[model samples]
Target: MADPHIKSKMDWLDYVTVIAYRLGFTLAAPAILLLPWEVETGIPAQQLTFLAAMLCASSLHIYMKNFRLILQAATWGGLICAIFGFPLFGLGGAFVTLGGLCFKEYFCFRVPGLRAQPILLAALWLALVLNATLTAPMVVQGLAALSALLFLVTAVAKWRMPLHFDIGDKTKYEV
Candidate 1:
């Protein structure tokens, strides 16, 4: 069988993606660390949820060097946040659900062309809007928007290449 693993066509866009990925992680790290660990009834569990979300976002960004793993982690993480977070953080959890949608679209539409990027980007936009509306902190809202934009731009710039590079011939999952 021929190998389906597509090598990244190294270019400025690839470099930009790496940088953007790193930047997203950097921004998400503080949010992860600062998230509240506990909450009282009647008080919004926003801090704790944000912390968990930040952890997932930063962790996923770090491990996203592998495309398949990135997809899986993002999907699972997003689902977890949506299911567990909604009760705890309300609309904030919905934003996480939207993020999962973005990651799913990114993997599902992985094609050797530029079309897949916009779909994924649209998902990111949904997430950003949700976050902006739910979270009161301007810093976090700004960071989330900037990170989403950066990743979207990076992915769009390299839409004609495989989303990640791995050498193999097995079909672990189909995009």
Candidate 2:
């Protein structure tokens, strides 16, 4: 029998990924309220949040052959766009990656509130980008708040799960 006390390299990677993932969302949850301060101080909370999120996404170990690769590509593509001054595309790509993660979590664990995350995140970004008069500022804020809460809940639940759960069956992974 495998010793439970023995921590594999995958275990360490999962712990680190979870920490980064949680930190990213924790920073993001208060983003709407912090926007004014971020703007005033030029702290760039949005960039930092995305950076951490990218790290988490890039490091994730998916059972499928190419799913993790696809996610990392999308994440890098988004981050590069943001760094190159394309904020809209950058945010869209990053959120899509995050939404993908949420979808994966929902599929794997059937976590409540996760299934709506992708739609909610997409809508939130679209409302901000379009600046639609029909979508009031308060509505945008409300969406942001809702998204933040859902993300926080998901992150917390993921953190609480067993480290080995993230690793899954190594034999099933494509080498």
Candidate 3:
């Protein structure tokens, strides 16, 4: 088994940027934290959930040592945020949550060549500008959900699975 981190080719600055981006996306995922800042129900549990989510996001971002995983989490977080927020904050929340999608697509993946970066950045800016539209915001929840689902499916497919099992050795389990 080889170390996958070496294949990422991301340096310290990339890691730092990714961590900050992930933190921002995760923080924006839950609407309660973004607006009003009030506990409508399950105050204790909500507090715990919020803490756990932030803690887990940080832990995963550091421990996994993989940028893609953080991006996947960001996509899912975006989906949850967009869906929950669309009902409450409408267009503004959707636009904000779309940042998660932008993080996952633009920041996480490499452009494969140096010539493409400027173009990509321009496209990213265009994306942000277009996100302000009411039409784009209306589809944020659905798009976020789709992006998250695709990321999950790709993750599962790429994961290594165990080949051998002990199910055939029933005799050894006899008590």
lDDT of each: 0.39, 0.68, 0.34
Give per-residue CA lDDT, model 3, range 25-139, as digits (tens): 3443342222222233434422322332343344232222344354345434544654585322232223323333343333333212223323332333344346556335434
- Show model 3 residue runs off by greater than 4 Å: 5-56, 61-133, 136-138, 158-175
Which number leads on TM-score?
2
Kindly list the per-residue Cα lDDT of model 1 for residues 7-112, writing each as its tens digit. 4344665455444433433333233223221122433334433443443343232223355354435434544655674432342442343345244434544523
Better of 2 and 3 by TM-score: 2
Q: Which residue pairs collide in model 1, if any?
A: 36-47
Let me know the TM-score candidate 1 reaches against the reference structure: 0.28
TM-scores of the candidates are 0.28, 0.80, 0.25
Q: What is the lDDT of residue 9 in candidate 2?
A: 53
Q: What is every candidate's alpha-carbon RMSD to the true fold? A: 14.1, 4.2, 14.9
Q: List the lowest-lDDT window of 10 residues for candidate 2.
A: 1-10
Candidate 3: Cα lDDT at 42:
36
Candidate 2 per-residue lDDT, tens place, 1-175, comes to: 0122444456565668656665655555565333324555788756765775675675576767577777667778888988899976787777777777777877776779888988987887787776545667776677777877877777677667666666665656675
Show model 2 residue runs off by greater than 4 Å.
1-11, 25-28, 31-43, 132-134
